[model samples]
Target chain A: MMHQQFQDCIDACNACADACDNCAAACLQEGHASEMARCIALNMDCAQVCRLSAALMARGSQFAAALCRVCADICRACAEECGKHSMDHCQRCAEACRRCADACARMAAA
Target chain B: MMHQQFQDCIDACNACADACDNCAAACLQEGHASEMARCIALNMDCAQVCRLSAALMARGSQFAAALCRVCADICRACAEECGKHSMDHCQRCAEACRRCADACARMAAA
Candidate 1:
């Protein structure tokens, strides 16, 4: 049985990963591919870290706390980068990142 | 410009994700769900971290080195665990995890 905070954080991480994956694919489809390069890159990074954080928590690993701290940092950074873009996918990704970051922060604190 | 090592690590991570995802799903389909609980859980965790590690490398994050170290550790652990199962998916996942762990270790070293 997982703790409530961990469960919530895991859910957020999964959601954020999906959003980031979608955003990266969408960014690739944009006409200005070069311009969206950073957004695309960060989306990939955020998506990966969220998955890592979720998995760590699920297993109740000793490293989960430390890892979640870094994950939160990455999520926030991704959100900031995504927020600069006007694309719908970027917008959605930013929101997911923000939520995941918050959840990770709470989990890390616990 | 990304280095060859990072690129290779990213590729391994992506491959590992696909393998782990398949392994987890297959584990669920096994008649003995309870017997495969640990395998299923580890597969899920391994898949997520592999995604995260790949993304970090793609973005050239400052934290990528440290994250990859932990990622390598998880991949190896997952590989060891997956190696215990006789199923084809588990065998495939173990191979992917082993490759990913080696790639991640090299990345972390560099």
Candidate 2:
């Protein structure tokens, strides 16, 4: 079994990924999906990182620290773009992003 | 505009999300979909958290620090589970996880 700390990070990543997908789907159905392109792109990117980060943590890779750093940066950007939207999904996504970003930062430090 | 650091985090989260979704889709198509249940579930969870974390960071939420901490933990766990599978996609996902996890950790520390 992996260390508890590592496991915790995985959980957070998973949650963040789900939130992003839902937010993206919601955005796609909105009237301004075209305007939300940046948000959509960021959301897609954030989701990808969350998944990758989780996998790396699983194997206890030596490069996980570096990866965490990159993932953290992306999450912040995605949040900013999503925050621009006035929809409930965007607002909820923004909240999730902040939480995930904080979690990733902690893991990197560890 | 958000500080460069925040923007970077968002970018990383979005990338990770895409990787996870792709990996999950590939996993679903594999013959051992039943065996990959845990990975799929973790993938889904990681994706959600990444989205939420990004959104939170976008708004400069005060709770972002805590959220990042959580996101990091989940990423680690999902990585571990995904690593269990011997498929190429799992391996790829594992690598992506490492990258995203490191990125997130950095954001948390910031």
Candidate 3:
């Protein structure tokens, strides 16, 4: 079982991963796929890292703190990129990424 | 777009994640959920790292190789654990994990 302190971060990471996955799929459906390339790419990266960080924390891995640090950085970057877009999916993804980033930062600090 | 060299590994990662998710969900539905706790936990961890490794490779990140090394280790462990179970979901998940581990190993060596 994961430590109680990491539960919120884990939840945030899972939520962000889901949001990012949805955002990437939505971006692919948009008319201007080329325009959303970076967003899609970042979404994929962010989603992966969020999931990995969450799992590491759940397992109580020694590298969880370091992984969370990197996860937070990627989440921040993804959020910034998503914030630039006007699509509803992107907006939602940005919000999720911000929340995950904050949670990951706290986890890293702990 | 990801480099052609990493495409197979990315596909394997995605497939493995799907399999792991299915396996975990199926494990929960079984009569002995407590008995499958380790399997479920490993599935979650394996799924997360596989996604992360795939994204890192897709982005051509400098850390992709190193990450893949760890991912391969986790995938191997997950596969071994899943293989010990008799359920169809576990069998399929074990296969996927093995494939992912192989792909990750190749990626890491590259």
Candidate 4:
């Protein structure tokens, strides 16, 4: 089990990963997917990093904070990219990423 | 659904991710966790990369090949690190990593 302090951040990371994955799939199904290429790439990276961060935290690893920092950075980037889109999936992803980034940043600072 | 060509690689990746995650949690439960610090770190990274690689392949991302190359590299490193340990989890993790590395390498070259 993760430490009590990590539960919120872990939840945020998992939710963000799900959102990113969903958004990426939605983007891929769009007619003009070429225009969403960068969004898809960032979504993949963010989802992966968030999962890693959550896993590390769950294990109580020494590197969890460091990984959380990296996770926050990618989450910020993903949020920025997704925020530019008007699609429902992208907008939801952007919100999730922002929430995750804040949670990870707080965890890293702790 | 992923292309038929990606099925084996995706399966390998998912299995490897499971192994690495299980190993990390097991390592945390073991005595002298400090000795397994590097092993745990590598396991976390390998698991994250494997999941990302699988997700990319599933979505037919253009960068899947490039990410596979990175995934293979990390899998090799994780295998080497886990190979040094005598624990059952570590041994199993090493084997999974090796298999994943081979599968990912083949995907990268495909």
- Cα RMSDs of all predictions? 4.7, 14.2, 5.5, 6.1
lDDT of 3 by residue, B1-110 (tens): 54878999989998998999999999999889899998988887777777777778887875677677777887898899999999999999999999999998999898
| Fnat per model, in the order shown | 0.37, 0.00, 0.32, 0.16
**Pairs in steric clash, model 4:** none
- lDDT values, one for every candidate: 0.84, 0.72, 0.87, 0.88
The TM-score each candidate achieves on chain A is 0.94, 0.91, 0.96, 0.97
TM-score on alpha carbons, each prediction:
0.65, 0.51, 0.60, 0.59
Q: Write the residue-wise lDDT of candidate 2 on A1-110 in tens digits.
A: 23335766766776666567667766766677898888888888887787677667754566777787888888888888888878887887787787778888988998
What ranking emerges by DockQ with the best candidate at the front?
Answer: 1, 3, 4, 2
Residue A36 alpha-carbon offset, candidate 1, angstroms: 11
- Candidate 3, residues A1-110: lDDT per residue as tens digits? 53777899999999999999999999999789899988888888888788778878888765577678778888898999999999899999999999999999998898
- For every prediction, compared with the true complex, DockQ reads 0.29, 0.04, 0.23, 0.16
What lDDT tens digits, residue by residue, belong to model 1 across residues B1-110? 75555888999999999999998888898788788887777777777777877766786876688788887887888899899989898999999999999998988898
Candidate 1, residues A1-110, lDDT tens digits: the string is 75554888899999999999999898888788798888877777777778777877877875687778888888888899899988888899899999999998888888
DockQ score for model 2: 0.04
DockQ of 3: 0.23
Error of 2 at A76 (Å): 0.8
Predicted model with the maximum lDDT: 4
Backbone clashes, each candidate: 1, 118, 0, 0
- Order the candidate numbers by lDDT, best to worst: 4, 3, 1, 2
Tell me the tens digit of each residue's lDDT in model 4 across A72-92. 877898999999999999999
